[model samples]
Target: MRRSVISGLSAALVLTSAGVGGALLAPAASAAPASPALTTGVADGTYVSLKPTRMLDTRGSYLGRPLNAGEVYNLKVNGRGGVPSTGVSAVVLNMTVTAPTRAGNIVVYPKGSAVPNASSLNFVAKDTRANLVTVPVSSDGWVSIRNATGQTHVIADVQGYYVGSTTTKPAGAVDYFPDDPWRALDTRTAQDGPALAANDYLIQSVSYGANTANISALAVNVTAVNPQWTGFLNAWNGDENAIPNTSNLNFASRKTTSNMVIVPVTHGVGSDGTTPVLNFGIGNASPGTVDVIVDVVGVYATGDGLRFRSVGAPKRIVDTRTSLGATTLDAATTRTVTAPSTVTNSTTVALVTNATAVSPTAATYLTLWQTGVTRSAASNLNPAAGQTVANMAMVGLSDINQFDIYNNAGRTNVIVDVAGRMDLSPNLASGAAPSLSTRTAPKALGSRVATLR
Candidate 1:
């Protein structure tokens, strides 16, 4: 036996095609009509909407007025409306549009005035054929409907699968919606709520530079020449070759100054040609100090300065210097202090000592539970869901004092290791990532490396 499916406007079912032959015949008088498609033509809520061929009318009128044929009519919706998206193969309408009107009926004025006429219908349809099958209607009303008959429940299925961001999601179709907030770039500037801008505590590289001098000849001068500090000043100002012929030197953390500063020193040894030191002048040059000018045309908040000394040859650190106040980090600040004498003890003890002394007196920052501290605002970097900022620190080792960094951020807490060596053990051990905040605890061996993840 074979099975075939049969559908109609009023009723449709499967009948045995098994040996039953070509087509199924209609029963008799009151049988449902045949349809070539799934949906029928009906009223459009929006400009384009799924419709049924035939409809019913519980209350029959157009805006409380009797409708007639051969008149222009329309339905209005508030927006750019499209097809009625009922995801069914067919549909049914249970409403009446108008009463039958002749070609020339009495004109019914909208403001309730009657005019002489003969047509009795509100609208007329002639060229347009009613569709009773599944059809796809373009937004512009370009429809593809063939010969169809009667009413159909499958008309709703012509909506085609559509995907959407709304609750009325249609499968396998795109949602023609507007842009969302998260989809935008950092226009207002915030990965958090509304306020948190993306910025960092930067040690402005623009304000820092090596002496603009070729620095050929140089000499140590607290007070030892025909013009002692002249050569030193010249060398710093981009003159490598000064009178004394022993002045090639590099400097860092010279002072904690906000304005132009001119410092003269015959102190620290030069690493240039011969690596010479001016061991002459005591009161003036035994210990070198860098002059400074702070806040030189840059974005700053509560300005600060720090003096760091990097050894060129991994030499033992005998002295250190700075220009910031005891608690200040200005370029003019000075620090001529002793450091570890052992090669193995590479930690610089300069900034570490200062930090230690200032620990109790320095202000502490308040950072806790700080994601969107306020409503609709951004806050400090809070770890993403299921993530944490673990093992983060900054270690400024041999790059600062002694021959190495002394301390930096701990595995648990945030700290700065002013003098610690980043290279150590020379074995199989993973290291921290590079970041500004990953300073070693002041007195550990590590570089200013940071860790992410």
Candidate 2:
């Protein structure tokens, strides 16, 4: 009856217990098999968008068995799905866990490396959850995933990858632009309509201001709230003919769940019917209706934007349990955590971090943003009482190199692990400003919609 998600690789990889909650498995006993030598240089830390593709689904033939406790699985990344076999430095994946037999944590690290004492996801028994992970790739084009407790099944869907930089920037590569995190859709609102009906699809326009032409993708967090039945949600580039067989977030009946989504963009007609706009589509695969909320944090575009720079591994920046940033964040309180000097050098403007709420005394959600701006109506992580949950966030950095985290409801400990940083592109055009546009309403896909049975 046990189930867990991980693929089979050579037995050379190893995983050992680190401790209790949030602690991940150890590194492999030896280095992973070496990859073919690359005559070109390393990655330049820019992104390349792709249509969503399913790379691993453990519930099916992939490994065909649940990943047991303390099991490490090396998944081949390069040359799989839409990713190139070489020249990849990192990848963006939406990771989901379902039917966990016991509560546990999931850690994702580059192949052959020691697992950092951090978790990419935390889930309880019989729960379904997903989180976005931007992981550095191993030299041999692979990454490892480990489960810390009872068996569970995992699913990984690739949305994009970062390429190596050479003397010349890779063609079609794009830079990142972090926004202040604004709400783009909420089906609960009257204007957007009621909760999404079962097996229906909705197309939502996301305004990129004047950056529409060059924008390749938008970084957004999508949440499903209080569904009438258990099921999942899928997002794509709004092309009616090419919906990927992937789910962005999963939820049980009456439960609220969220996941970060790097949705590719496509041009479409705006509300007025003639104005061109950028849009994406979300489809519900459940038997019941559910409310959907979307919040945009950033965008990917060519030229004059922030470039991504991945760290060797994710670094823990704040751990309230150890008083690293501060004591426990009390209910309705805000804490300003300064960025590490190493990641906040002159060129850096924002950080990509995994924010976790550890064993809160009561149900709560955490909101993160730059210190200078007002807190937007967006949350990065939402955890029930006594649950430890994590979600990836691209948080802007204020003038003083600081960002704020606000805890709602009861007191809880917070942990932030830095996966990468966004550096001001050296190619930024002189005097060009980067800003986010206002939120738009949702549009019914009508005859173009793909209904899931």
Candidate 3:
């Protein structure tokens, strides 16, 4: 069933660069009105990676039309694209919004729930943007997305899903280990050299030092800086023969964009026989060059690690515009943002949050990490002068359930939306919650542009 409201990686120690294109205009604010905090149960589950597949495209294959302003659309997520018909708790998707008529934000949540005061991504008029989203599914395996302004076409490619612990752990179930944010690649440096040329691919090894063993996949933030032409970037496990058809992020000429990517890794014994070496690839698909930055935030490994727990619909826990986390953050300053009183569970080791940078005074970036943890060189969101943008971030939390947001330059308001959290495996629960559908639609036939991996 489809309902309507309108709403809307990778590893490696190595990096590359690309060229610049056009400037992007700031989009309108997308946050819903503040509502009283609601109590939500934890959904513990293990991670499962699937062959990336295009699940929805509004242009032709799916809805066959653009979404209107303030509309909500619910798309079936489970029992398709390699996801199981039952037992799936959440899904990992790379969602793209293209040809928007006007600037607006995209909000996504579990089907049958009230719209939450948050956004999944923000975009300008006639812009093409993409962000990775991890969302919980309703009992019948569906999630709702809303487009906050103007008509836009949406595309989603499924990368993986989380299965509840109550169900038998499927083969290849991986546990997650949240690492301190670390910058593994920065192609801007002379050593890494020249921006990435169109159609060029770079392979780099990503390691977690002592924690490298048993690592199967990596959670990294991928940013395209000053892309010279309008194009997209593809990330994968470095399999030369099988490059995925999906794009990790889309960027315009000269505009900077970032997305969270969870990519499986190809492993090898390092030069030091005892250590493991994990590597992945990034390919540029544009007419010009662009710089690429990869930041490792977490790892997926077998054996012991943490499971994910859904927090129902995303919860707006921080709004800098209000007294929430102090007014707009100034350049080079950091502020502490605490979780809501409802998410005080000691089991919360990390959170899956959508962080937005609104109306930045200058082109700048924001980095998020736990309050007491040493700040990492990684950045979560990058917004051009006066541009409003959002990106998903998986951040660890301090002992007091607090985290910090640091602005790189100029003043900008920050908004944090909690989608889910990482918790101990023992806390993982089972069973599905009932949900009602809003709109019914025909099943998706196939993508207009077929790119299945």
Q: How does each model score on TM-score?
A: 0.14, 0.86, 0.82
Model 1 residue 251 distance off true place after TM-score fit, in angstroms:
37
Candidate 1's error at 222, in angstroms? 43
**For model 3, how does the per-residue alpha-carbon lDDT over 1-453 read when each residue is reduced to its tens digit?**
000000111111111000111111223232222221222323347788876788878886566788778777788888888888888889998989999999998887788788788888889999999989989988988887788888999888889999864546776677776655556666786545456777777766655444455666888899999999999987887766777888889999999889999987786555456545676778888878889888777677664346788888888888888857556799999988877756447566678889999999999989988776568777899899998888999876666677889999999998888889876445222211111111111111111121223
Off by over 4 Å in 2: 1-43, 167-171, 271-273, 429-449
Write the residue-wise lDDT of candidate 1 on 130-230 in tens digits: 11111112232222111112221111111121111123322211101000001111112222112111110001011111211111111111111111121
lDDT of each: 0.17, 0.75, 0.72
Worst 10 residues of 3 by lDDT: 1-10
Model 3, residue 94: what's the lDDT? 90
RMSD of each candidate relative to the true structure: 39.7, 11.6, 12.8
Output the better candidate (1/3) by TM-score: 3
Point to the candidate with the largest lDDT.
2
